[model samples]
Target: MSAEVDRGNLRSRIGMGDVLVVMVGRVGEAALVTGECEGWNIARTVGRVSLAEAAPVNPEWLATWLNSSYARQWCLSRAKATTLQVTLNLAALRELPVPVPPLPQAREFLRLMAVMEEKAQVDADIVRTVPAVADAWFRAETAGGWLPTSRFGELVRIGGGSRMRPHPEGAQPGPAGYAGPSVPVVAPADILQSELAHLARTGTEQEAAADVPLCPPGSLLVAVREDGVRVVVNDVAVALGRGVLVLEPESEDDRYWLLHAIRCHAADLASTAQGAGGREISHRAFAAAAVPWPPVDVRARFAEVAGRLHRRARTAAEEVGTLAALREVLLDEFLAGGSRTSRGSSPAHGPSVRGEGVQESLFGMR
Candidate 1:
């Protein structure tokens, strides 16, 4: 960031529609084009906009730059002092710098993105049919094959638990001094995952220090407060935070199978929300939410397959996590103009125009 790019009275002097508010991020972290905005406030904030006349020459690459690993890392580095919580700065953000690649290079990036886009559309096709496979297995088994039927509420107790306070200042700093309730505090984002549940362990001393909620042992932690759909958290070692529901299913089969079932019905969960303003999800809404309950034998049968899906899903997630770690490693190398990837690939995943920014999906865990 430099002083010449600084416009001291620039914000207050701008007129309405004098600029376009440009938002930048991978599709996951940002929303754009909700509408146009322009003003002094717009110029001062990350989400605000102004006219094309304001400064258009070096702007064409803004979105791509934001999408770039170098740029994304820069934004993230500037976000906060801590690693766990995200905190973006407004003033520092507007002062940030970007490398303006020539138009030809920018077009090459776009062309590469288009190719990755088509391949990804194929990957997305599997996303649509997996649920039906589980649903049909349930139906066929409950109707005649192996499993029996019961009301969903009969098999599990679904309850929304203690309300959560947003992390007071960001990620809790360091060790909580002692180790009594070291089980991690969690959130919906934490459990939107596959494999073992992870929460940052709060010291029992910390719980005594700060009065935290207990995570249920057999509960399937679910994110219940979104408009029509929600995503599971991508990280482990986090707890079921606010805006989540915990399901304590009766049977071992339920433990093994309920996660898939809920994901199948994820849309319904979102639909039932009383989203008048901020997201509002109730225990009653989730408990009353139904699923196709098949007999025990049918559940056993479904579990046989779902167990495999769950295992494969877990492995896939682990692999992606490994790739993400690798992406970070290679990003550091390539961005420094290193000759090759640590993994031996010619060009690594992040720096080049690869990855559509959607996290690769894995069947979430219970």
Candidate 2:
């Protein structure tokens, strides 16, 4: 609520400088209203906070603070929770204390955040655009059923079936009486979480022996979920865990071709997944699926283009991760004034944003 808001005219139409807060489910998720979305209508479960035109606080800065971990806990603490959902009322949101710096300092803080946010948006766009482009190329080359087809099993070797050990450490054991080097373990969750057509790393690694199912770099990892068949080209050597299948291509040319081929037929392959869970892919059904096998030279041509697009996608995904981490770090630093910060470091004992030399170094401000 602001002094300028008319009581009768406060409709759902959003305005610039309005902060949209989720009132249900995710409770505290908030975003700043920009010019692009200024006139959009908000749902009933959303609460809009409008600021007077002469308000000293920046809307983006307020929105950023609302989305921080501290504010999340604050909102959740006051929200009414049931087994199914959590709901925050307007009164709780109105009581949230916001720390405001001078307009120029707040704007400077936001400028750095905006730079990282824009870079991340660009990378996210690449991750989404690459798959469509690659899929189009696949359809164009394989159109009209002109290329001779082959069973999927014949084109590549399928590998999987290493189970996770029941040990407390969650490590995967090898054949008895064997000890060897460790490699990152790819699981169903890893494949499902990957946004692009490539996977750069996994969260956990296990000691692998000679008998463990090992997928070398450049192999396609597939995870059949309830939604569809998820796939990614692993850029590093990784050991496979249960529910993760590896498709090993014989050459570099076959790599991208098989990658896109599996993506284009994701729905058909997912149809084979049948069980009580309906999330597991039947090996027999997958082995018999028809795949378009074009000439090696034609595949090489598609590979040359698709491969470049996927590689760029992977690079962009990596940058997205880096930018996200840095943004979180900056948010924690900015929001925590003289108290200990999330990274376990504190600014020189004074105001967090003003007149502190450390602020200049942290935000890259001159």
Candidate 3:
């Protein structure tokens, strides 16, 4: 949505509770607007179309239904080919059949969705608050000290990792003749904020040592993309993937402090990123970025405090993931069984559907 365009002649205005369908490119994507977007101008070139709910159909319920497999299949069947992408016009979308369950059943589904949404907001709040608190603490701790500001290159060695080709064959021994323990590989996606130990792939120790450098514990891993600069402290030794840069601090104990410092300057790093396809901070540029270098005692004390806060944030994030998974399962079950019948009647049972049992297990009720 653009605010620069004149809104006087625009007939269709999106408002709070409106559902938007991405009709082109990533064809079936849908979203519900939780806030007002009345004055902004929407471009049809982006392939977005707004939906307003009529009586007996809740906007939230309709948005959820549009995201389900049934709606996706329907949209795919009706899509027309464009020069470079598939698209569905508003007329075609109108022809897609929607299940109209009883009003009471629709209300129940909305109620459940509200609960999940509330929990998601709480999780987001926790994830967002910890970093802000840490940033503030860092500023306060560095305010009084005669802390020298040093380029990251002066305090750490920065290096990019290798792109290892995937092997076609199943699990075997080391790279050809070498034999040693399997080395876990860490990619940019595996590097979470303030915590890094996620291993998505594994390779032979020989391959890791020979082809790609292994980042040791206390190394800072950074993702150099425009999405945002993500920084994490590695808790264990692992082989690095191509998308991440490993920052090895001269003083191993300075790892946590360095991670927090980089995080504080994340916005600055992102602004300095340069590239055509995606904004990226080059290895040399990232290494030359300035950071606050406080006294050893101050760093150690801050590290201890920051570590505790980061641990709590990690736990909260994990809980959010679990809750999100539970919400997905509930949505699947609710849509499958609850949509088949009216309010009072029992939903038709099928071999693949175990809605009642799953709900009972989840809520401890039959």
Per-residue CA lDDT of model 2 for 1-366, tens digit only, reads: 333443333476677777888888778888888899866666667887776555546578768877766677778889997655678887777777666666676787799988888989999999889888999999999889888999878988876645662332356666777788878888787898877877777767778777666788988888888768988888888877777777889988898888889899887888767666766567777778888998999999999999888878878888988887787677666555424464544222222222111111010001
Instruction: Tell me the tens digit of each residue's lDDT in model 1 across 1-366.
Output: 223333444433333332222222221132122224332232322343221433322233444345445555556666654445455554444544544334564566556545554554443443334445655664454454344334457678765545453463344433357434334565554444322322223221113234444545656666644444343312322344567666676665876567666665677767656556436566666666666666577667677885565454445445544544544454445334455554433233223322212112111111
Whose lDDT is greatest here?
2
TM-scores, all models, native as reference: 0.53, 0.68, 0.65
Question: What are the per-residue Cα lDDT tens digits for candidate 3 across 134-162?
Answer: 87888887776568888888888888766
Model 2 ranges with Cα > 4 A deviation: 1-59, 65-100, 162-182, 205-212, 325-366
Winner on lDDT (1 vs 2) = 2
Query: What 10-residue stretch in candidate 3 is worst by lDDT?
Result: 357-366
Give the winner by TM-score. 2
| Deviating ranges (above 4 Å) for candidate 3 | 1-4, 8-12, 22-29, 43-56, 67-98, 149-151, 162-218, 223-230, 233-243, 249-253, 267-282, 288-290, 338-366
Q: Provide the global lDDT of candidate 3 against the true structure.
A: 0.62
Which is the better candidate, 1 or 3, if ranked by lDDT? 3
